[model samples]
Target: MSKVRIYTIAKELGIDNAEMLSILDDLGVSYKSVSSTIEEDTVELIKGIIAEGGSRAAQSGAGASTEAEAAQTSQTQTPQPQTQVQPEQVAQAPATAAPAADSGMTAEELAELAALEAEEAAEQAATAARAELPHRAPVVTIMGHVDHGKTSLLDYIRSSKVAAKEAGGITQHVGAFEAQTSRGKVVFIDTPGHEAFTTIRARGANVADIAIIVIAADDSLMPQTREAIAHAQAAGVPMLVAINKVDLPQADPERVKADLTTINLVPEDYGGDVITVPVSARTGEGVEDLLEYISLTAELEDLRADPKGKFGGVIIESRVDKQAGVLATVMVQEGTLKVGDFLVVGENYGKVKAMTDSAGKRIKDAGPSTPVQILGFSEAPSSGELVASASNEHEARELVAQRQEQRRDEEEARKKPRLSLDDILGPLSEAHTVNLILRADTQGSLEAIQGILAKKETDDVKLNVMLAGIGAPTEGDVLLASTADATILCFSVVPSGAVKKAAENKEIDLKSYRIIYEMIDEVDRLIKGNLEPVYEEQYLGRAEVRMVIRHPKTGNIAGSYVTDGLFKRGAKARVTRGKEVVFEGTVAGLKRFKDDVREVRQGLECGINLDWDEVQEGDVIEASEMVEVEQ
Candidate 1:
């Protein structure tokens, strides 16, 4: 008889290869991989037993054996003299059917079939361990560009002043909250809009079941907005668009809708699947509609969890609460969490002493999709740490200790001696290149720096950007840079204190700057082996325009009084109105009491001519001289 491969039979039964192999193991059946074949009669016996246990169904829709075959086989092997098994029962228990037909089967086949029966009995006893958990609130992540009303919309929905609480109205950390709308309660994860928090935003997108991409009606789609869309897409979650700030006079919902098409997120009104709703985070217009859509989405997803089984969740934020000790905000993804449950998160272990919802209301239990603050962790877990409930305190402790040991080992491995610049450049004398890890505050800045560095390559030396990312330089980046013998360059992103300390410990070269052009210029200087400062600007004098005097031959000249230093005739002048510079040119002409003069002293009145027009009264003219200096 032909033999059937385990994988081919498993595929027919709609069972995973690994699961089938485990089942075969429990039955004492011989097999190597899933491709290992078994006797045809043994395969028929196992399938009949699986069908009898109701663990699986026949691949062909017609029961175990067809009507004609079952009748013929049953009549031949099963005699009415001793005991007769019904045909319906035989059909239901197909594995036993083969045995009744072949009463003289081998002992090995009999033993394996008996083993499967015992295993199915054991499984039936342990089935339905937990009651079915009801559908939970949808966890929605809010993401957008800075000043695009993300926090404002969250504030209005939660009815809290979170925006006001943020320093400079910029969210510095990820915030999780639960809000009760008329439809039902919805959990919201507010991610920082700045590009420096890309990791945090990605984490938010990862944990959320739904994403709300906030777009200001007046502000076009920005780089961060596109990044948010990309993050949401990469996470494979459903998304809703919130067109905020509709109350503003310049708010253009239609224009925003049109711009969204560029990113393939066409509005529902435009025959697309994406739901776009206009809302005013300031005055609460159309806010209820957004919540309704979220509720509908949750219903469509039919989100559920096992309430009585193992509890698992993701850590949203963790900090050492001065009064409460280690407090962590967690979003429950499965099962139910209660006070006094043994929990393990990352390298920490503890019993849940207390739990509270976003409103600070003490709760004894938290279900799936609920964000709660729990106390009693042995150590503060990092953000994005996954949480799991253990069977007992001892088990949790053991897991925590094991994880801590693993982390220590990994850290020690990373501390291995790193390569130095001399180690690389010293070996190559003729041709040399500087490997650099570049980090910037925004995606655009990172791309610009990478482009500039790539274009600046030369025959003698080349500037290679080993890694470029939109975030503050992290310790991992420092380690990579150290291993690669690369210097780290940061533009408009300040490294955290911990990262800075790590870099110092590693003795890595890290250069940070706020201006993009300055960083580019320094890299240019480094590439050309020109370390000396060629020229530096010095403040010459400042003057306030008292009157604007226009001439046919010369451009707009300002009748001004020297405020500080001495105004030189050939010094560069910058005209500033308020905080913005209006014009930058050289001081073409200077006159003191109608006498052509090269310089005018402070506290004196003079007439200054500039190359540009629009010299308004009360505008301040700043003069500076370029003086060549040594390195």
Candidate 2:
């Protein structure tokens, strides 16, 4: 049977689409949006819910919408006339099956389309087997402030000296390990505690089922400690506090508990749900209790994944080894990962040549919540990327090829001209913009830098970070910088002497910094003083708001009439109420009626959605474009 959309079913029952969507969410049904197709079984399940007196709303209790309750009652007692199924009610099939145009597509486009089909197929298969999967282990992550004994605690649990092996006695990398507790097996992820590793720690929380926050008893709560708590809470993961260094002479668990209460993490002993355990990683005190608490929490969560279907997981860490080639530490989330299985990780494909557990023992297979070092990736996979086991080597290779093609297409799309040759030779203008290329040694550093640079903008001066990537600055970077009249900024990455010489020959500025503070300082200076203005923003159009439509997946899409000039998709827009600027962001999407267009002429109606922080119905949207000019 062809899948029917949730909105169609809602229309048939004479209920609001949003109400039905909430019902599906309460029933634990997976859906991307109301337009998403539902299986035949799911359709029957909804009918059964209506047939059973529709008590699901009451069971949800407090804050239940009375209108929704009436709608459910009407669904059961009265049968509305059948509505005609709309063309959009049918889920569109994979685009790969659509014949290419007469001109045919490039190999890259074909590969990307094929990869999308494969991924959609995999998702459907995983959903089919989801209901039958048994409960799996819960993955827990440890996060805290620097020198708060996070690694030391993991070492005590695993009986290994990982802390001693770390550089500068601080955890710099995210590590995953499994421990056989008396209650059961619990997987643990150790995340770095430094402020610079914020992205890594957030990724850790995102993938874990539970979080253990370590706070030194002697020091109480620190700034990073608060940040770690915020990350775990933002991920919606349950957290348990581990007060470490309690064996110290100055250790005070009560003082730490008071600080935790201030952050809204009241201890269970203090009449709250947050569980706080006192322990000393140095002496192993209260460590067993901590393990027991973790097992109990996992039992309550009832975490599970299919062990009989296609294997899938996420890459926690990856590095290139001289002898082992590309080794990746992967934590399996669903199904069973066995030796010799063909796998696609990010843009890399490989056959599993060997699997070693955290203890260095060769394992034949791994199930959910198991972290193992696997050898065989063709290249180093990125951390936090999803990994799926394909049916065979051919399928894995095709998937990887498709992903690589998609990446290339995205890079090409983002390759706007930083500065054309003619523009560079022209005189200065009013709009001062500094174009830059950023290269970093790691993903974490790149993310940190991007976040920092995004906030370095002024009314007249704009810091446009054209490209950011991992690895050292290369000749290609120098060429791009020379063409765009942009500078090459490197963080913790040194360019080869030959590349530096090439940059010097081209008279392109190349700067490198080991410290984030120093890099930010230099970028600020360049944006404020060194960069010359070449263009100024000119008003392209103004639109009067007509209506606002809230899309489930795309947020708010505005319906407006172009009052003057022309409205375009790529133009920058600012929302104003009266004379005050409410928001300033890009026009991320635009449409005319049902069809999408590049631009709408004056006195035309169109739909627009901004990348702005917020949008209201009556806000006036003023669009502008930067126009080049000579002084």
Candidate 3:
């Protein structure tokens, strides 16, 4: 290593930032800040100084050395660019005999130099791309606690009952709108306020020019409200506090302001730069002032994008619309998106047959900062992935293929996958081997995955691609994988009910993924002994209470309407009544029109029995299940 940041070194040694600074000061090492990088030799000296500090420091140093050794080992395992050097370069080396001082450095040193050059080139390319991109309208993200009037505020701006149309009158997914206010044209991203959609909120903040954190005046600061602020700060986006529900009798804006100071978000009135506006989403009071503030802030920031740069955007959400096939909502960040443009999104490629704005109005084209729903993809693209234009259909396909191949090759095998209980506890085979039966939606996807696995093959650890095909996994595949103790991986394809049941019975590991990166990542993490916990709550569905049935025998039967996702009979459930989780239990029973049911999709009505009597009208019921997953 040439140089490393002090914070990075501290992290490697599992020590606090302040402790690292203290140690550096004690050693008489000169550093501008924790972020300042020091030379490799200086770092070694610092390590030696720590080792001499006593036994406690010595033990820490020992642990840190082991960690450093492991990191170095992994780096050595990585294939070097020099290994793929062209024959012309090797032949030309002898021509420069005068410059070959002691035959120059070894292959390892040369490889490191090549890696550094490659990194610098990549950074320069990124800088050039950013400089060339044109600027567009300001993109603002709305974030806050559940039922804190985020949707209501947008509804007011758009002059529509958006909240009323949403499931449970709560936003379930991210939605973007281009608002042409009196002040200026600004794009707003409405992110789900529910805790389950924290990732989406973070994504929203990441893409936004400003974050308007909605805080309910009556509620002050809730858990999700605090989380929203943290996300905005982490994303480095300018924030404007919107204290909503100001019309409520119990509303107290002062309490919200007080809580803001605790989080280091002091308002302008409190001798801080943070701007706070009290608004009533229900009545639209003070909303005009909020818009003016956002517009002014956006103008001051001078956010820009080049409309002539390569067309690109981020997928806010993608789904299979039963009538329209694959539909993806993309917010154009640069260049221009047209109706007939062919685009590549991550590993999926598509042609834009049509483009519709947030209001479902069809349009010919969209510029930077404009959100549009595109139709005519081969399949639904992965959410939060990049979507950019290709020269043509053939070019789009080729581009996505190359991307998938590069992605798989770039991923580190032992650090990619989520940790299942089986992965963490299962004993490794005497022979280091990973057997797999792979299935994909397309031949290209299958080939891409196989190419990466081939590269992962080593003398010590054998990677066996036992079966690679295009389609959902069959019962036969499951049986063979079971007998061989191999894993079954499905990319963009799902196993049938029979196949799932067979795998369950045989205790075979079966995994499915919609994105190529996630599939490869999970496989990389499959190498046991290098695992991280991946137990996550997978959201199933959300529902709203239509009517509460006080059944004589069945406790409280919630006559609910499914809002978002689906509801399973035995799924883990939570009931929220106006920002508070009133009940957390299981979906003990489910029914449709008085008939017992196993599953219910969104936009449907069903009777749900939580085995709890506290079910009330207007309460939101969310269904989820804990499973091993990754980001």
Each candidate's number of clashing pairs is 2, 0, 9
Q: Stretches of candidate 1 above 4 Å error?
A: 1-133, 160-174, 190-205, 405-631
* CA lDDT of every candidate: 0.75, 0.76, 0.76
**Per-residue lDDT over 1-631 for candidate 3, one digit per residue giving the tens place of the 0 to 100 score:** 6889776787677665677878878878876545456889988887776667666777888999999999889889995443454434544454332433343555444455666877999999988877565547898878888889988898788663222333344332336877777756888776544231334332332457888889999998875675566445545678889999999999999999998896677876676767889999888899987887787667556578888778878887778877878878888888889988989877878788988877666789988898888887878765567777988989988998899888777675535767875665444433467877788998789879888877765554576666666788876566456445678999999899998998897789999999888987877776543333346889898999989998899898999999899999999999999999999999999999989999999999999999999889999999999896652
In candidate 1, the residue pairs with backbone N, CA or C atoms under 3 Å apart (3 or more residues apart, or in different chains) clash, namely: 48-94, 48-95
TM-scores, each model vs. reference? 0.47, 0.46, 0.44
Tell me the lDDT of model 2 at 306: 74
Which residue pairs of candidate 3 clash?
133-306, 134-304, 134-305, 134-306, 135-304, 135-305, 413-524, 417-522, 417-525
Candidates 1 and 2 compared: the better one by lDDT is 2
Q: Report the error of model 1 at residue 404, Å.
A: 3.5
Model 1: lowest-lDDT 10 consecutive positions: 194-203
How many angstroms is residue 89 displaced in model 2 relative to the true structure, after the best TM-score fit?
Answer: 21
* Tens-digit lDDT string for candidate 1 (1-631): 9988675687688775666777788889965444357888878877877777674454454654687688888889986564444434444554542455444543445555666777987787655332135667788878887789888888787764222333354322325777777657788875544232334333332467788888999997875676566545645678888999899999999999999896567776676667888999999998887887787667656566776667888887788867878888888888899999988877677889988876666789988888888888868877667789998988988898889999898888778957675543354436666777778888788878877787888777777665566878777566555545678899989999998888898788888999888998878777765222257899998999999888788877899999899899999999899999999989999998778999998999999998777899999999999897753
For each candidate, C-alpha RMSD in Å? Answer: 29.8, 20.1, 28.8
